[model samples]
Target: MHRLLFALDPEEAHELTLRVLSLWSERGPLLEVPARLLRVEDPRLQVEALGLRFPNPLGLAAGMDKDARALGAWWALGFGFAEVGTLTPRPQEGNPRPRLFRLVEDRALINRMGFNNRGAEEVARRLWRFRERGLAFPVGVNLGKNRDTPLERAAEDYLRALQALEPYGDYFVLNVSSPNTPGLRTLQEGPFLDELLSQLRPATPKPLLLKVAPDLSWEALDQVVELCRKHGLEGLVAVNTTLERPGLQSPWAREAGGLSGRPLKGKALEVLRHLSRVEGLTLVSVGGVEGPEDVWERLKLGARLVQVYTGLVYGGPLFPRRVLKGLLKLMEAEGVRRLEEVWPPIP
Candidate 1:
């Protein structure tokens, strides 16, 4: 299944995969076999963050279900939470075709998909339907600005999306980190960040998290951490996709856009380690995480929650269950009963 999907254009494969998952979500019988094979339940894996309880610490990261199409299928696939969208105030066609590439050898993906989605109003409707049907796990909405929105007025776009979707999401992610949108990463800096957060903070009833880029300097990261604290934000989704392509073996290495998967693991971990030192901020780690050891390491390193995107492309549907089960074994070996207890171990 994975190889066949890989044979098609990356974006087409993605859409086709979503359609299958959406069908499974809409019909119970279709999910039975996969759910039994994939779902791993353990009280010890429960994690409480941002005022919501995750059945497990693992999540399906943003970009996978950008329009909230498969919210119902995620838990069946073993993810404890699912974040949807990079949804803008309005619909967008995103970047031109062939914008998504797979670096097979590197076990990574590079995409310049510029926040393609069905718009906030449309996605909010889907979210409401999911809610009406009863979501099985926590869901977050990742907010992004429209492609044509002026960088100066970017806050207005995010504010619009936030207002429309806030009632439906368990939490909200302000996505200023994606490299595909022109001038979007710039919003991570001083006044622009402050202005955007200031405008959205009061209106956001749910916990607000800022997703940041992996390419930030230590100094810039410090500023972001401080600003997050100062602004009363709930948490940080450490390290979005990276623009750097260091020591990659695939021919697709030179392709433009943010690089995710194994190539991003090292830097994403470094950024998470740095953020762990900050006293009050919650950290959700993403990037390069593929299996149980990676999830365990991130939790020990101080990530309250961990998310995956590219890992799913390579690891198949049962990946989350495998990771969760692996975590249980690790916990048993260490004689710890809870994920939180495994972290900051006694010396």
Candidate 2:
């Protein structure tokens, strides 16, 4: 069954899966019927962060269900939260097809699937309906500029998208680090980031975070931390996919895009370890969180929450439950009485 999906073109498989889940999302209480079997509703897994409560630390990262199509399905799959979109103010075609690649040998993926989302307003409408369901799942909106937006005016794109999405999301993420968008990564620089954060911080009272790149220099990373603080932003989603393809075995390694999954574990952890040390920011670790131990490590390293993308593509729908169960075992071994007690963002 899984082999059929793996055999299909990555994007095709993704769309096919989303279509099925989108239908399932419309099922209302039926979604919870599966939740009874799939969701591991332990009080120990509850997490409080960004002034909102999450059922667990595990989240479906942005770029997966870009249109908020499978939200109810995600909750049924047992993800504590989900972040959708790298949405722009306007819809886009994104980079041409065959833009997403799978690296099975490396348990990884490479995607330059630009910010190809159905614009903010359309997605907001979908979210509004999802909100009416009143599920406890926390959804995050990750905002980005359109492919054609000038780097100088990128803040305008984010601001407009935020205005459309603000009332819906539990939190909002500024996704300036996606490599597929030309000049997008430059938004991480000192002045540009400072300006971007300055403009966006005042836009919403919702929890706002900056998602950073895995390939950044330590100094550049620190510059981002300082600017986030300077702007009074909430926290960060550490280490988005990396452009550097270090020691990859797949032929897809040559593809021009950000590489994620196990290949990104070290760099993601490295960045998380660094950013987690900062005084106040809540770090949401992404990049390559595959299994239960991966989430535990991120929590220990200072990530108040963690997100997964490539891992899900390879691990299948039951991945969330498996990891959540494994996490419980680890917690029991560590004698952790509660998830919150174990994750004070260890130095």
The per-residue C-alpha lDDT of model 2 at residue 295 equals: 95
How does model 2 fare in lDDT?
0.91
Rate residue 96 of model 1 by lDDT. 90
**lDDT tens string, model 1, 169-204?**
999999999999999999999889999988888897
Clashing residue pairs in all predictions, respectively, total 0, 0
In the order shown, what is each candidate's alpha-carbon RMSD?
A: 2.0, 1.3
lDDT of 1 at 315: 95
- Candidate 2 TM-score versus the reference: 0.98
| lDDT score, candidate 1 | 0.90
Worst 10 residues of 1 by lDDT: 338-347
lDDT of each: 0.90, 0.91
Residue range 86-184, candidate 2, lDDT tens digits: 899999989998899999999999998998889999999999999998899999999999888899899999999999999999999999899899999
